[model samples]
Target: MTADKKSITALIIDDDQMVADMLGQILQDAGLNTIITFDGKSAIKLYLDKKPDIIFSDFLMPEINGVMVLKAIKALNAKIPIVLFTGYYNQLMDELKGEIVKPDRILRKPFIQVEKIHDLIREFFPGYEIDA
Candidate 1:
């Protein structure tokens, strides 16, 4: 069954407050609720409590990092979609090559393409339709 667009929640984890907030804003604008955390550790807690439909995490974080978040969340709910964001996309890609568990998607930094974010929600969630 397709979930209601308004009921969808996105978890955003990034050590950089600006980047996290910016991504949260973009998702919020698309009619999804957002829960943002500045650390991967706390993000784990939020993920458990909120049970968000999707996750957007930065590859480099102070304590826990995005890969850790990805593994932890995947363990909890493998069906949930997790998107890893990194400026060093190439390096992260190489790092993930041998890993058994990896993020469902990887987004390049700067978050320049707003439509991409909207498209992700639409792709994962058939009922979600956000204007470009």
Candidate 2:
């Protein structure tokens, strides 16, 4: 196992418990050690402690938003990968570039393709295996 994949921890930050749970399950199935948080601040703490290989965060949350979380995570660990799970795509990359950790990928909310998720994980950790 590649060190990055084996160390591939993912944090899902969203206010909706269901969304977080759903993404967490998907990430787990993709062979990642997953952590789900409800807000950016908590996600920041989790990211700092876990130093996860990737993060999937909701763009808009009741409290701290994904942008803030991204900034915090980048400030702590610039190399860690983050994905913004969003329904609102307008100005997403442009607006977030300076404020948060630029996500390697954008996963639309309620993603229809699990394979795409798998692809993202694979993209980050090329040697990791995915179960059929």
lDDT tens digits, residue span 1-132, model 1: 667876899999999899999998899888899999999999999998989999999999887889988999999999999999999998898879889999988999987899988888888998767743
lDDT against the true structure, each candidate: 0.90, 0.79
Candidate RMSDs in order? 1.2, 2.2
Model 2 C-alpha lDDT versus the unseen true structure = 0.79
Model 2, TM vs. native: 0.87
Model 2 regions lying over 4 Å from their true place: 1-6, 91-94, 97-101
Top model number, lDDT: 1
TM-score of each: 0.95, 0.87
Give me the candidate number with maximum TM-score: 1
Please report, as a residue range, the 10-residue window in candidate 1 with the lowest summed lDDT: 123-132
Error of 1 at 47 (Å): 0.8
